[model samples]
Target: MPLSRQLVLSLFSIFLALFIGAVWISVSNTKNFIEQQLSSHAQDTATSLGMSITSYIGDKDMPLIETMVNAIFDRGYYSAIVLKDADGKVILERRNPVSLEQVPSWFINMFPLSPPVRVTELNDGWTIAGQLSVQSDPGIGYGQLWDNASDSFQLILLMFLVGLVLVWFLVRMITIPIMALVKQSEAISQQKFDRVELKPKTLELRIIVDAINLMSERLSDLFGRLTNQAERYRDFAYSDELTKVGNRRAFDLAFEQILSDAEHQTSSFLMFVRLSSLNQVNCNIGFLEGDAYIKTVSDLLSEHLNKQDIDFTLYRLNGGDFALIIEGIDEVTCLDLCQQLIDKCNAIEKSEYESGTAQIAAGSFNYGDRKKAILEQVDSALTQANFNPLKWQAVDKLQTVQSNDTWREKIKALLDKDTADFIAQPIKSFSGDEIYQEWFARFPEPDSKQHIPMAELIPATIRLDFSQKLDELLVRCAFTKLSSQSGTVGLNISRLSLLKPSFQHWFVTQLTQLGAQCSHLVLEIPERCLFSDTNNFLSFIVNVQNLGVKITIERFGAQIASVTHLRAIKPDYLKLDGRFTKNIHTEKDNQLFVHSLVDIAHGLNIKVIAVQVETAQEAQTLKDMQVDFVQGFFVGAPIALEC
Candidate 1:
């Protein structure tokens, strides 16, 4: 119960007890007072009548004696009045049975009143001539007692109401500070430090308030320091000194990081921007003018990229070569952005800096889990764009690895119709125990047996705005496949689907309906998506995990800048990108990276899974690195589960 209700009930109970006691005592006392008054009244009337009737009895006037008795009885105060001779013979008598008006039978029975009969001797010239007797009515006294009780009850009821109001007010006042403390504590749970501004008047509550305020202040300071440290580390390691954008070191980190993240590995755009003929401009004008030209291009790229609201990283690889990695974008949007960059370059004041026109080249590809491969491909695309800078052939070199208009239409039909074929890849741990089979969707070519890999098809789904529908189909099928199984089945969710409201609702509802099967399911999310709008993603993760599904970060080391979120989210598993595990035995740098990644993940009790383990030597290296799970062709290739 809430404190306010408890207090009110407690007060009401006490009031009820006291009121019952008071009414009982008041009723008892009133009954006794009425009884005594009735008895006294009867005695006085008999005495007074005896004195007045003596004269009439002495005269032997029977008519006068009868008249006196009749007059007293007619007054309605006495139930009976009688005149009798000394011989005990009744000479005159008047009597009437009394009935009370408006008094209930129950009340009269509970407070029964019996008035005493009084007899007085009448002396006729010093001799007792006759006796006069009178009995008072009990009805009059009962009516008075009943009226007194009714009035007392009304008064008591009024007091109870007034007392209740006062009690509620007092309880509310006492609880105000307590409610404030509760709200402050709830805020702290959400990582928002807040203090109790109102000091309680009670000594115990005052102490509690002081403690809450001190704790909030300490937490606020600590979070501020940690956030600042993370930002400083990001700036020093990745940002270029002159441009304040990512330096070459930053580009290397971002490229490795994005490739490591399974979610961002595929369906991303990489744009390479170069200041064309800058050396000639430096010879014609000055080094300072060339620097100005680079700065101008940097500003243009930053301004345009920031406006897109997509997750992208920018880096200045060298004086004139710039690189951009934009995630969750379609080919057309990527081409449009490339055109915008080209326009900005063409619009650059060439005469002012004595610089040649700018050259921008862009390439789109589904990451095959290879960092070096993407770097080479984008570099080749940049070379192609420079061949004809005069025509500003920036958009021509933009190419997608598996995307064409025909492929998109085919993939769309497959997804919309839910007719895509899927294959499952078995993932085995270092202990040789199969953890789960990772499911992949395949779309057959228009007229050939060749099928499009998921890496190529997923980007199209995202670009086409129907990733949610495809994800729903995939989840349902995976659940159906694992219905009677005792082992876990894992599948990747579309990043685009995670961002959609309708998709989240449908996914959560489906998982709930899966019942026990949900417990045997593992879901994969790309780590790169955690860098921006993380609250929504975290909420999504929690909602699904609440249904007993395990959540793992695919390509765990993809975006190092947002690694702090891992501690807060605590995902069940972190899969190291395939690039890191490809040749782990011979590559010292890769081994070192895996060692650090495993250490961090273990510290938080998050198990690490190594991907693309191609050889026995690489698997041994991963085990030595303390990797918790391993997956590759060396262990086993993806095979259909025997249903």
Candidate 2:
């Protein structure tokens, strides 16, 4: 029962007990008082009647005496009246049998009144003529007592109902603060450090609430500092001092990270824009002007890349070189973007610096291509671009998406059908025991797994607004898997599906039906989902967490506000980005970044998961850093879908 209901019931019980006691006392006193009054009334009637009948008693006019007695009896107050001669012989008697019509039989039995008799001597000329007696009617007294008692009971019942209503209201008023405190405590347990703003008027509750607020503030401050520390570490290690873009180290890791994704499309390229006249500007204009030239080049590249929907990364590879890695861009589009940058930078060089100008080049690289080979190709192209008037060149690169009706119908058919299934990849501990199996939902490709159709279907899922249907299909498969199994399974949910109102309602309802099986399920939410619609995401997190489902932030460490959001969310697992886990043994910068990140997550009691770990060296390095979980091919490739 709710606290308010319990308190109301308890108060009502006490009220009822007191009310019963009060009613019993009132009814007893009224009964006694009525009985005494009836007896006294009978005594007065006997004396007064004896006086009046004295003259008749001496004349021995029996008929007249009877008439007088009958007159008194007819009034209905007395039950009986009797007269006797001075010789002790019965003379005349008048009696009236009295009964109360309004009083109930039950009340008469429960509270029976006793009739009282009074006797007085009747004297005629100094002689005791006869003895007159009168008996009081008990039915009359019973009727009066029943009426008073009935009225009192009705009044008492009305007061009790009103009192109960007041008690319920008061209990709710008192429990509101308590309920707030409970919710606050639950939020804290989930690692959300928001303070409780309600200030209860009760002295003890106010004190408790103040204490909780102080603690929450202190915790929030601590996490804020930790997040700042982590972000500072990332910035200092990866950010270039002059250009403020990612350094060469960041570029290499990002390159490896994108290629590491087996799901990455085959078409990719690396473009390098060089400020060929930096030396001339430094020698003649000024070193400050040379630095200004580099900054301007970096800014232009960043602005262009940020505006595009394409996958790209900006890095200051050297004092004169800016490297950009773009994926899935066709040859024409790549050259167009490169040509635009060269023209824009050359305009600045000719107008202000009067030094040389800019040269741009890009080269295609597919998955599994060597980094050195691709770099050589792009650099060689840049050398040729310097000789060309256009000042831009590129190695062969072209790939276009299939957005025809057949492709759309193909994707729609997959979503509408039950051909999609889940494949499990183990997330292991340092000792190699399976901690969890991250499930991948894949719609069966007609050709092979190597040419998975997600590259085409993914855009369809988003563009066609069918992400919710896809997610629902996978979620149902996951539920079936959980029901038949005893192991933990993790499934990824689309942010789009989570945002849909119908999907959200269905998901929550399904979880309630799943009940205890929820403990074995983990939801892998993408790190990007945290930023798109934060309030809804937080509410979703709280709701699922309350229902005992675990949340994992997948593809972690790609966002700007990662640390702060992670602290606020306090998810059970942070699935580290593949870049951090790639070549970690040989990469000191990545190692330091991963180490610091692990410490931060550990401080909050959240576990870290390093994903896409391919090599043994990478796994060993991550284990040394105390990463709680590792998931990738080296740990175990995804197995066949369970039926």
The number of the candidate with the highest TM-score is: 2
What would the per-residue lDDT of candidate 1 be over residues 389-485, giving only the tens digit for each residue? 5423333445555556765677666665554555676788777889887777555665577775555566566666656777787777677777767
TM-score of each candidate? 0.69, 0.77
Candidate 2 residue lDDT tens string, 1-643 = 9888789889989999978877777788899999899889989999998888888875657688778788889888878887778887777777777687898888888787887788899877777778988888887888889988988888888998899888887787689888888897777755577777888877888898899989988887876777787777778888888877788877888787776676333356788888888888888888998888888778877886767645566788888988988764555466677877777776666554543678888877766678888888888988988888888887644334455465667667666665567678889897878888878777775445442445456545655556678788778867877898778888877666776668878998899999999988888887767765677777777888878889998767755446657666778998887877888899887888888778777876888999888889988899889999888888898886657
Model 1: ten consecutive residues of lowest lDDT:
389-398
Steric clash pairs (candidate 1): 257-558, 260-555
Candidate 1, superposed: residue stretches over 4 Å from native: 50-66, 79-98, 114-135, 195-214, 241-244, 247-250, 257-271, 275-294, 306-311, 326-340, 349-405, 420-451, 462-643
lDDT of 2: 0.78
In model 2, which range of ten residues has the least summed lDDT? 446-455
What does the lDDT read for residue 472 in candidate 2? 85
- Model 2 off-target regions past 4 Å? 47-59, 82-110, 117-133, 150-173, 259-267, 327-350, 353-357, 396-423, 428-436, 439-525, 533-551, 560-573, 582-607, 613-628
